[model samples]
Target: MAHETDPVGDLTEAQAREELARLADLLDAANIAYHRDDAPKISDAEYDRLKRRNAEIEARFPALKRADSPSDTVGAAPAEGFAKVRHEIRMLSLSNVFEEEELVSFDQSVRRYLGLGADDPLAYTAEPKIDGLSLSLRYEKGALVQAATRGDGAVGENVTANARMIDDVPQRLNGAPEVIEVRGEVYMSHADFADLNARQTARGGKSFANPRNAAAGSLRQLDPEITRARPLRFFAYSWGALSEPLAETQSGAIKRLEALGFQTNPLTALCNGPDEMLAHYRRIEEQRATLGYDIDGVVYKVDDLEYQRRLGFRSTTPRWATAHKFPAELAWTRLEAIDIQVGRTGALSPVARLSPVTVGGVVVSNATLHNEDYIAGRDATGAPIRGGKDIRVGDWVQVYRAGDVIPKVADVDLDKRLEGAEPFDFPKTCPECGSDAIREAGDAVRRCSGGLVCPAQAVEKLKHFVSRAAFDIEGLGAKQVEQFYSDGWIKEPADIFTLAQRYGAGMQQLKNREGWGEKSAQKLFDAIDERRVIALERVIFSLGIRHVGEGVARLLARAYGSWDAFVAAVDAARDQGGEAWDGLIGIDGIGTVVATSLVSSFAQEAERASIDRLVRHLDIQEAERPRTEGSPVAGKTIVFTGTLERMTRAEAKAWAERLGAKVSGSVSARTDLLVAGPGAGSKESKARDLGVEILDEDGWFDLIEGA
Candidate 1:
C-alpha cells in the first residue's frame, strides 16, 4: 500500500480504490476468523482500525465502492448445518471509524449529505456489540412465525425450530406489531458454558473453545431437542424489517421490542452527541469483563429514523452506525514456576505461577499449563519441565488471559534465559503422599500409585461425594467436609454414613469448636441422615469415579435401572476383556475412556469395599422413569400455549410428558393437539387453520383426568 500526501485532503480516484479493496480484504479475513472459527487473528482495536480505514477510503472515493465490500456488508457467509432462509428485508452491516479524526470526518460527511454544519449536532444510540451470533426473528399476528440466522446480509438460514427452544425467545408477543422482524444475538452464559464444557469433557468429547462457539454450535445442531437442552439466551439489539413501523427512533424500536416480550440488551444508552457516545462506549468497555458474556466493542447508531434514512447505506452496510471497540486485553508476563496439582479425579495438571499482571481488569497470578508437553514447551521432551527438563526456573515466557479469566502461557522468550537457572524437577512421588506416581501410556497426567491411600486424592474424592449435584448432604459443604476429614470423623465417602455412629458422643465436643454449635451439629447429622436414601444417579455421581459426571451418571442409572444391575454390569465389564468392554463402548453417549473408567473403578477391591460399606447404611433409591400412563395426551404430540388456569405451563408440560407425550413448542401439522389457554394467539389460529385438535384448559383437564 502506498500513501499520497494531499494537503487539500482530496483523494485521487485510483488511490481511494486501492485503499477500499485492501480494507475489504482485511475485514473479510477478520470476520472469517471471528464468526467461523470463534477465534480472532487481530484485536478489536486492530479490526476497528481496518474498518475505519475502509470507511475513510469509501468516503474519499464514493464512485469506487465495491458491491461485495465489507463496508457494504452485514455479516459473513451463512454458517453450515442450517437450512438457508432468505431474509424478508436485508440485514445491513454498520460503518465504523476509530480515531477522533475519522469519527469527525464521518460526522462531516453525514452533515454534508444533510446540508447541515458542525453546529447541527446529531443524537445517537449506543449499545454493547455483543460477541455472539446474530439472528432475525419474524412474528406474524403476535405469534412467532420464523427465526433466521444472519447469514450473508441478503440471506440467512431458517432456524425457527431451534429458536423456539431458546427460553428467552417469546412464543407469543404482547403489544406486538401485526408483523415484526426483531434482530438479536444468541449468547451463552458463562455458567452455562462452564457446565456444558464440563459435561462434554466428562463424556470424552472435545470441549468448545468458548461460549460464543458453544452457543453457535448448540443452536445449529440438527436436532432441535439438542439445542433445547443447551442454556442458550437471546437479547434483541436492532430491527431488521417490519411489516408495520415499530417506533420512530432506534431507541423507541428497542423499547417496542421489549414491550413485545423480547429480551432487549439492557445496556443500551441514548446519547445526544459524539461525546456522550464516547462516554457510553468507555463505560461499557470498563465493565466489559464483569458482564459475564463477551463483548468486542460498542455500537453507535443514529437515533433519529429520518437521519438514518437520509444518511442511507453504501451497497451493503449502513452509514448511520459505527463500532467503537475496546483496546486489546492481551498482555505479556513471565512464567515464574510450574506446579502440578491433582484434581478431584486424580488427573494432574501443571499450573503456571506467573509474575503478577493485569489483563482485562483482573489480576492474574496463575495460568494453566495444561499438560507435560505444555510445561516442557516441546513435543519430544518426555521429561516434563517440572520433572527436571526444558522450561527452567528463570525463563521469560509470554502469558495471556483471553476473556479476563483463563490465564495461559502463550509463548516462551528463550532469549531472556539467565545463567545457572535450573530446569524444574517434578517429583517422582506424590507431593501430598510419598507414593510412586506414574504416567500411563498415551496419558499426560501422572497418577498417584497410592490411589485411595493418597490423602490428597482421598479428600478430593470425599468432597466430590458430597457435591451439590451428587448426594448433596445439606450441612456437609466442602469446608465442613475438609474439617471433618482433618478431625478424623471422616476418612472416606463411606465414613460419612458412620459419622453419627462413630462420633455420637464427640458431637458435644464439635459443638464447642469455632462456628459450630449444638444445633448445627445436629443439623449436620440430620442432613446426613436425609441423604441415606439418595437417588441412584446421585449415588453413581457421588462415587467420585473419574470421567463420570451427573449426565453420564444419569445415563448409567437409566441403562441399569437399579443399583444391583449397575454394580453387576460394572463387575461384568471388568471380566469381559477388551472386546466386551468395546461392546459397552457403543452404548449411546458412552465413549471408550468413560467405559474403561467404569470398569477400572470397579476392579479396585478397596474402592468396591468402600462403596459397599457406604451403601450398607444407606439406601440407593431407584431412578424414577417418566410415567406415560393412560392419559389422553399420552402417545400424542401436544403444544401448550398462553396462561393455564390449572397449572403453570412448565407443570403442565411435566404432567403431559409423564403421561408419555412429546411436548412441542410450536403448532404444526405434526402436532396431534394444541392445549390453548387464555390469551392464546397465533398458535390457536394456526391450530384452527391446520385443523389440528385444539383443547382449552377445561377440556385438557378433562382429557388428562388430573383436573
Candidate 2:
C-alpha cells in the first residue's frame, strides 16, 4: 500500500502474492463502483498506486499473477440501464507515468520498440488528460449515428440520446470519413457543476461528489430531457474506428477534428522530446486550478500515426501513449480502528476506519490497509516504511488522495500515538463462519477454508453473479440479491434463472413479500427471462470462479466458441496432463495458473453441478466472431514469418485481423497462408513441408491489394 519507497522490488513471493490478491479485489471493486455505478469508492490516485504496485509485483513474480489481474482489465462492464454497444475498435486506456524518470523510460521504451536511436526525432502530442467520462461518437455519412460510454474497452453503454443533448457534441460532421468514431471526454465545467449541484439541492436531490461524477451521471441519464437540461461538454482528442485515416500525425488529427465541428482541446501542443513534454506538463499544471474543467494529468501520445500502429496495444493499454499523473493531495486524520472484511474469494482484507476528514473535497473515513504486514510497519522484504512506525488505533496519521478520489493512509504519527495503542493481531479464523483462515505457502493473504459455507462469501458470490459483467438481471441489484440470498430464494447463479419459476405465482410468491408488488415482481421475472439466453462469455463469468474475469472469460469464450465446447474442454483438462490441458494453457492469455483454476472449478463436484444446472437454464450463444466478409483473407489462418518490409509485425498482425484472417505465430498444417519475408527460415521450411500456401512480401501485398 505504501508506494513511496519503491517496495515492490523487495517483496517476497508470499508478500507479492498477498498484495496482488488484495489489489485485484480492490481494483475490481473500484472499477465496478466507478465505471458501472458512477460512484467511486477510492480516489483515482489511490487506484493508480495500487494498480502500479500490482503491475510491479506481477512483473517481478509473473507466475503468482492472477488470471483476473487488473493489468489485463479495463473499465467494468456497462451498467444495466443502457443498451450495450460493442466498439469496432477497442477503447484502450493509456499507461501512466508519475515522475520524470518514468516519462523518460516511456519515451525510450517506445523508441527501442520502433528500433530508433537515442537522438531519433520521435515527436509526441501532449494534451491535458481530462477527468471525465470517456465517450465515443460514431458518425456514418456525416451524421452522428451513435454515442457510447467506454465500458470494459470492448463494449460500452449506448448513450446516443444523452450525447445529442450536449452542446459541445456536434450533431453532424462535414468532410468526415464514411465511418468514423470520434473519441473524447464528456465533462462538466466548474461553473456548470456548481450550478447543477445548486439545482439538485433546490430540487431536494442528492448532490454530486465532483464534476466528473456529475458529468457522467448527467450524460448517462435515461431521459434525454434530463441530459438536455444538464450543461455537459465534450472535447474530441482522438479517433477510434475510421473508414480512412484521419491524419498522418496526432496533432493534425486534432486539428481535423476541430475543423469538423468538434471541440478539440485548445491546450494541446506538440513536443519534440521528453524534456519538452515535461515543460508542457509543468505549464498545464500551473494552469490546472484555473482551467474550469477537471484534468488529472497530461497525456503524451506518439504524434506519428504510423509509429502508433507499429507500436499497437499491450492488452488493456497502448504502447505509444501514457498519462503523467499529478501528485497526490495530503491531509492528517485520526486512525479510529482496523477492521477485516471477507470477500467473495475468501481473502480477509483489512480496512482502516478513520475519523472523517476531507483530503480533496471528499469526506473519507476509511482506507485500505492492503495486508497485515502493511499495518505491522514492514514491507515484503522486511524493509521498514513510514520510519518503521506501525500504524495503531488512536494514532494520528497522514492520509493522501491521489487523483482526488480515495483517501489512503501514508504515514503514522508515532508522537501522537496513544499510550494504550497496541499492535493489531490479525484473526486466524474466519469472522463470518469461524472456519480456519489459513495462509498457504508462498501466499501472502490468509484465506477462509469455509468456501461457500461462509455466509459472507455466499452472499458476495450471488452479488457478483448479477453484476454488470455477469448476468446483469435488470431488476436485481445488490440489495435484492442480498435479501433473496438471505431468504433462501437463490443460492447460486442457476437459482437466479429459476427465481420466477420458484416464486412467481406460488404460495411463496414474491409479490406477496414486503417491499415488492405484483408489477415489480413481474418486472424482475421479465428481466430474468430476458437474460435466459445469454452470451457464452457472460455465462462463464457468471460462475465467479477465482482468477476468471471478463477478459479471461472472453478469451475462453472465443477459444471454445460455445458453452458446450468450453465445458468439454474444461472436463478434459481436469486431468491436467493431456492435450486438453496443453490446449487450455496454449490460449494467448491463459497461463498454467489460469488453466488450473478453470479445470479445478469443474473438478469440484458441487461447483460443477451448480454450473451444469446454470447452463441447463441458459441458451448460451457462441462468441461473436470478427466480421471479415468481402475480404480475400476471410476465415483464413495466416502466419507472418521474418521481417515485413512495408509494415511492422504488429501492423501486419492488426491488418490481417482486420481482414478477418486468424494470425498465428507458428506455421501448421491448418495454416491457410504463410507470408514469408527476407529472414524467414524454419517457419518457411515448415510451411513448405506442410504444403501451406507460401507468399513473398510482394506476393502477399499483391494478393490482398484492394481487399
Candidate 3:
C-alpha cells in the first residue's frame, strides 16, 4: 500500500502489520490462481515483487510476524481427489546458484564443511534438473507399490496406478534393496507434449501450456486411463528409506538404477571439482535444447555418499546439493514505442516495441506492458510497485521471459532515460474501434466495450485467421489483410475465398486499384484460391476462437477427423456446463477452462453462421492421424532461419510439415535439425550449441526430396 518514499524504517509497527496482512491475503489468492486454476492473473516478476514486500515487512517487524508467515511457505495446498501419502523422508527443495560466483561460493562452502584441503579433490555428479512434477516411488522387495507427488514436502497425493502407466517407471527391479524409495522427476518429452496437445484439441479440449504442465496434469489424472493415454517418462535422481546401501557415490547409484531398469539422465557425469562442475554445467547448457525434454537447471551432488551424509540436510534442502540455474532470461533494451492490441475477449493490452535485443537466445523486439497499473508503476489500488518508477519512451528497460512465452518489461532504468521523455498516458478509447476502453470492477485489463461490432476485434481476428500457423494464405500478410478489410474487399474468412468472384472478374477492378497491377492482383487471387482445399486443423485455427490455439485446433481436427463431424459436434455441444460439452473437460490438457471457451464460441449464433459461410466456400479436408509409420521426417522437429537460397523459408516449412515434421520457430532440445541460410543468427548459434543437425539450403532440399 505504501510508495518508495515510505521506507521500511519509516513504517510504524501497525503499518508494517497491516501491510503484512494485505500481502498474505493477496499472495494466497495469487497462489490459488496460479497453482489450482492454472490461470495466473499476474506475472512471476509481480509475484516476486509482492513476496519481497512481505519479507521486508517481516524483517522490519519480526515480533509482529504472523503464524502463517509467507517466508516459510512454498506452494499452495493440493486440490482434493487423490488420497494423501506422508513422505518417509521429506523430498526437500534445493539451494540455487544464479551466477558463477554463487556456484563458486557453494563449492567453497562444501570444501570448508568437509575440512578438505584446497589441494584435495572431491567428485560431484552433475545431472540435468528436470522441470517437471516430483514423484516418489516406494518399492518393497524391488516391486513398486506406491507413488506420490511432492505435497508441501511432508505429504503427497497417491497416484500409483497413474505411475504404473509410465513406461519409464519400472514395475519391478532385480537384485535391489528389500525396501527403498526412489525420488525422481516425471516429465513429458517435447514431442510427446506436442502430440498430447494435438490429441486434446482433436477432442475439443484445452491444451497444456508446457511439457512440465502436461506431465503434471497427466500424472495427476483422476482416471488411470487418462494417464495411460499420455506419454509420461520418469528419471531416477535421488533416494529415501533404503534398507541397504545402494552405492558408494551419486553417479554410481544412478548407474545402479539404470541397471535396475530405471531411466537416469545420460548426461549425468562425475566432475572432479568446482571448475569441472562449472564446465559440466556449461556443456549441459550448450546441449540443453537437444535433450528432447525441459530442464530448468543442473543439479550437482557430492558424489561420495559418505560426504553427503556428513553434509546432511538443511532446514528444507540437502546441504550437499545445489542447483545452478540459468540467469532469468532477461536483458536491457530501449523502449522505442508503445502499441495497443485488443484481444478476442475484448481485453486491451499494451505492448512495448523495443530496439532488437536477445533474451534467452530469442530475439525479442516486443514486450508486454501488461496493464495500465503496470505502466503507472502501481498496483490495482494505485499503490507503488517497482520502486514507483514509471516507464517512458527512450528509456533503458529490462525485459524478461520466465514461465510465459511473451516478454515483459521488468523495470525501467531512470538514469538512462532520455530528457523530454513523456510519461505514457494510456488511451481511454480503443485504437481499432474508437469505442470507450472500460476497466470493469475487479479486473485489471481495460476492455474495448465494443464486442463484435468493433472493427479492431474483427480485423485482429481476421489477421489471426490468415496467420502463418493458421490458414497461411501466401500473399495475404497482416498489412494486405487489414487493407482489404478496410477497403471492404474482404470482411470475413468466407470473404477471403470469394475475393476473385467479388473483384477479380473485372480486370480494371483489381488491376486498376492503387499499388495493384494485373500481375500482383492475379497472384493474390491465385494464392487465396490455392488454399480453398484446406486441412480441418487449419480451418479450426482460422476460426479465431479464444483459448483454442493451434494445438487445441489440431486436437479438435484429429478427434473429429472431418470438418462435418467437428461442426456437428460443436453445434450439438451447446451448453458449456452440460455433460455433452465435448465430453472433453475431463480430458488431459483440455480441462474445463478450455472446453468452456470453445463451447461458448460455438454457442454464439453469429459465430456459427460465419463458420457455415466459410465451410460452404471451401473443400474441407479431414485430418489424418499422425504419420509416423515410414515418413523419414516423421516426429522430427526442425527450425528454419536466415535467408534461404532455393525455395523460400515458408516453402521449406510447408515441406517439413507435409513430411510429418514439426516446424518450430526457435531451437530447443526438441529440434532434430536446423536449416540455416545466409544471415542466420541466434537460432543457428543455439542449434549448434544444442548439437542439432545443421542443414544448408541444398542439404534441406536433399533431405526432403530423398524423404
How would you encode candidate 3's per-residue C-alpha lDDT over 1-707 as one tens digit per residue? 34323678878887788778878888888766654444556654466668767877888889988887766655555669989888898877786777789888998899999999877988899989887788899999889999998766777789999999999998998998999899899988877887888889988899876676688888888999999999999999989889998899888888888888888998999998879989998777655544677776799999999999999986667889998875547656678999988886778899999865545434466899999999989988889989999988888888887654789999887877898999998989988788999987877889896766788888888889899988898878999888898898887788998888878886569888777899998898888888988888888888888778887887677666898787676666666645557466654346666776777777777877887888888998888755555677887888999899888887887667667777888999989999999878778778889999999888887766655
Q: Number of the top candidate by TM-score? A: 3
RMSD of 2: 20.0
TM-score of each: 0.47, 0.49, 0.50
lDDT of 2 at 488: 96
Q: Write the per-residue lDDT of candidate 1 for residues 204-280, one digit (tens) a residue.
A: 88787667778888877779999999999999988866777888999998888888788888899998777777778
Ranking by TM-score: 3, 2, 1
Better-scoring candidate (TM-score), 1 or 3: 3
Model 1, which residues run further than 4 Å from truth? Answer: 1-328, 379-392, 402-405, 577-583, 625-707
Which should have the higher lDDT, number 2 or number 3? 2
Kindly list the per-residue Cα lDDT of model 2 for residues 159-277, writing each as its tens digit.
99999999989898899999999999999887888788889998889999888889889998999999999999999999999999888999999999989999988899999999999
